[model samples]
Target: MKFLPIFLDSKAGPILLIGAGDPVRARLRLLLAAGARVRWHATDGDFAVAGLDAVAASRIERLETNPGAADLGAIVAVFCAGAGEIGVTVAARARASGLPVNVMDDPAHSSFIVPAIVDRGDVVVAVGTGGASPVVARRVRERIEALLPARIGDLAALIGRWRKAVHARIPDMPLRRRFWERVVDGPIGASVLAGRSDEAEDSLQAIADPSAYAGASAPGTVEGRVTLVGAGPGDPDLLTIKALRALQDADIVFYDELVSPEILDRARRDAVRIPVGRRVGKPGIGQDAINRLLIDAAKSGQRAVRLKGGDPFIFGRGGEEIEALREAGVACSVIPGITAGLGAAAESELPLTFRHEALRVTFLTAHKARDASSVDWSALTDRKMTVVVYMGTTAANAIRDGLLAAGRSPETPVGVFARATRPDAKSVVGTLDHLPALVREIDGGPAILVIGDVVSHSAPWRNASPTPLFHTFQMAAE
Candidate 1:
């Protein structure tokens, strides 16, 4: 909004430098480094300035007079420094010649201003405060410099080298973008950042020509990988950046019933989506069918993504899928997300593990394991431990009975966070005895049950605020 930022073609022609001062010398170094030819124009016989040694000085062409249209036509931009009245006249001439002109220490009379630059070779970042505050811009540039790895530019250059080859190999734009994304965000990019150019080049070569480099890890070969991604609770905002990348890079995505539509929308538009089962009793597509689909997709050299709600490794049955993929010789990885319980706890302002309050947290799936009585309910009766139950709405009665039978008091405070972190999310606070009643109120759409003393102390369950948003946390009487 302040100033239109553009990278001029320095190689097109020479950049005219008017006057010989400290500013002029600094601009010369930048121009030379950017591969710009410079024509030095000065009235003084001694055209020397500080910092420029014999080598850089000899490269500059000395111009006797102020540059006319012919000279301006041969140059990309003009930099004037400490010329006083003569400098103003030179700036006017450069502007009349239709060349972008910069007058040092005066932005009002200039068409362009030199920015505080963070130069990382091929990757250059320019920060300008519209000539308002150079110090502020320089400070911001320093922060960015610290954030970016020293070898990031090298990584970029490496990718640039393979750009043509990648385009030739992958004709499709979407697939090409995905390939590059994997290269930059995946293991290849990591290798480059860590100064492992050799490994990065090898990986890049393998991707470019799978047939020539058939190592097991070679990406686009007959062998493919399955990335298990957690979509987080119902809110797309809660999804991790890594999870989003996995979806965008996926050739096919197998999602759970609890996975929200918004999260699925983030995946590549052309990606094939298969709905796998996660609903309480609704038997959608079985797990065996899902496993076969993933294995088949990978074996055919297509990247597969298994999108689950909350943390996949939590109650999402990710271990089972991992085991199946491993058995079929398919390479796989997991990208963890904010689980339903954690997201719910945050939204409700409930601390799962508070000092001197709740010392430990436990996550348990309400859906009984193959052996119905396998769960050690007694172990979960610790007063200091907070218990979060996933998919527990349907098994509310069963959960209450088990906890009560395990000698846990019926007066134990419990909170139900339904559709946690979503805009339309709701929560209920009540005693263990009221668990089944609270379950009845919920529509059974991805809920997490939190039990412990912490539940009563949370913002949502305590004194409800007058705002409609807080009304969702409907409290039941003792």
Candidate 2:
């Protein structure tokens, strides 16, 4: 961040405003609305207040003296808009005095830049682009303004009123924080936001114990739990809303290696992150150890999140994690995500099941040659069944042999989609006999192999030249 975002106390002291014209007038309105007394030095001598109310206009003290030569002792900050050379001169003086100053549209001379703001009484959201693009900032501010509840400021004010009592009641810092979380995320806050502040006040006052209200079993101990969240096939946007919430609420996150850094970036900034996934060849903290970590985190009254790539239930060992949490008496919940196979199919425009040509779809894992050999390939030999093989890159040759020996046609179309839904995603398409070769054409693994005639209907296949054996398509970065 080029400039640290902070809300300066508008009531600190009178702001020195030296400028003229409509831009200066706009800045004047913003300063007055923020409740700051202004010491105005209108360079053009046009001290007009045409639209401002009497009370606000009365606070402005217009001066004829040049601001550069005036006393700087009482000024808290400085703002210069449409002031030309005089603005730059005043900016240098303010900087020398160690005061914050903003020269409109001039970041080089300004100590701070104003941001596009969304105001809702006590609640305010500021959007900035470090003086790069005001339009972009305004656009973001619009989105935030729409998402925020109209009375969210009322809810904040309500909390402010009750904060002292709650803080005294729940002296433990963590428990006190959780108590506020319960209030803001629960019915009391909802009531306030719904314009029922009186009812919300009564509800808050009726609570006998703030600690108990915060979900603590005792006065000082908070109740912690685990949430299994799906990271969703490499793309951060594919994450479900609930999954996003869990990440934000997590006190600590135990994430898989497959979870993208962009996805992890969405978690609470202060939350502790620990990687616990096993890579293809490299060892990881074992599953038993991972389960113990989750149990321990909850036992210590920390909200923990086990972040897995793709839907937790679909070959993600989510069921196993749930069992472990249950056995350890840890409360848990699950949020599903888009699995890799489905993500790959959508990204490549490949249908897992097509009309008539493919009536059934099967998803299985083949991490090793022995694993592929043990599969009941005969059942998968049906011409109408589409087969999706996970972790099949290394065992591609074995997969090809097993299906061919099981009476599956060697000419069946197949696709290898790698890094599905990511910027560097790639795909290779060919017949079943060349499935291993097709896999070899891809740059890397963490890929899935799709087999059956349905692969011929994919975008990659359609876009490819009419090659008899194979076609490769490296997807351009989005």
Candidate 3:
């Protein structure tokens, strides 16, 4: 590293500066503004800069230090404030004498490089790349400084004024964290970011109790449904617009298993995150607890979002939760996400329905068939029908055997997708006759079982180069 960084004691008297260039003047201005006396040094034995400030210039003498004559007296730091070889030579001398020094435009001889600093009243932001690239650092600083709202300083100052009151009102760390989450997510942060400190202050003050405002005043609350969104199989870029809006506006989030942690991270950092996650076939968060939590949050007047994986309404137990919300008189809605079937189809380049290949489609659950003994064999054996079985990976053999025994084609193409749509998604293509055994061989994920002739037309696995798919479901008209 050519340059080092150090903090200077601005209280040190009379900063000794050698050379009289623009760099020298700029450094002097900073010192003067910070209330420091400065003494300038020049090699010509005369003051060279014109119209300089009224600093005692008689002491600004020649820089011909004859080695032994070099004084280690009262100077705290040195600045070689001129250009070319002279500044370089002087910097070498200062370094040898163990004095902290800055050489103009020369990182090689400098002990420290100055950072680009932004000062907005009491708000200061400093940017530095440690002199690796000053121009790049400056440009980055400009971009960041531009993004800061002019009124942010006002908002910050306002918040600072009330810090004592807030601390007294909510001293517990958990409670304070929860309170701040709502204030930042609901309206205060937005208002401040938009340059409306008054509005931000009002919103922040309203958090005397966040749950008390969980009505329309709360985002994602009230007339707004607490739509448990299925972020769809996995790829974050595939989120539906409705889901995205819900995530962006959510005041609190309760996410679950199979849902991407990366997707949950998309929510506002200040939003209260609750993990009510569950795993398939393992005892999970009780349904009653989840239902009560959702209702309690809604009644408290907060935008409560329950984020899930795949289609919330598709084997995600979204139906039971919606029923619970409805019974509690909470307005509820659902945003369908890409089910495993569709995700696999898209990633594997297989259309669930092709031209004239699949005239009918059916989504079924093999886990709890209502009529295992009463299934219409003829109806299922129809050549034009495509069946998508949810959560059937474990019972794949029974499903495949039933289809074959029902006079269906033995070679009917079957596609099994594991972790569909995610970056690590994979698909297996084979016939229904061998699908049961194949399911066990593959590393299990959120599996989708597609049995249909349409699978024949799909090409081998392909990449899911992102698109909008989460909100693909038709919204029910109010």
Clash number by candidate, in order: 0, 0, 5
Model 2 C-alpha RMSD vs. true structure (Å) is 2.4
Clash pairs, candidate 2, are none
Order of models, best TM-score first: 2, 1, 3
> What lDDT score is found at residue 272 in candidate 3?
92
**Which stretches of candidate 2 lie above 4 Å from their native place?**
1-3, 67-74, 92-98
Report the lDDT tens digits of candidate 2 across residue range 346-404: 99999898888899999999999999999999999998999999899999999999999
Q: Which prediction has more favorable lDDT, 1 or 3?
A: 1
lDDT of 2 at 247: 92
Which structure is stronger by TM-score: 1 or 3? 1
lDDT, candidate 3, at 166: 71
Model 1 lDDT, residue 234, Cα? 78
| lDDT (Cα atoms) of all candidates against the true structure | 0.79, 0.92, 0.68
Residue 207 error for model 3, in Å? 17
User: What lDDT score goes with residue 321 in model 3?
Assistant: 97
Cα deviation at 359, candidate 1, in Å, is: 2.5
- How many steric clashes does model 1 contain? 0
Per-residue lDDT for 1-478 in model 1, tens only?
5898898888888888876666666777888788777888764544766666676666789777643332566767888876666667778888888889998888977999989999898899999999999999999999999999899899889989988976776665545665676677888899999999999998776654533233334444445689999888878877888888888778889888778788889999899998875566557777888899999999877789999888889977899999999999989999999988998898888999888989999888866533214668999989999998877777788888888999888888888888887776878777887888876666666788898989877877666543212224642311
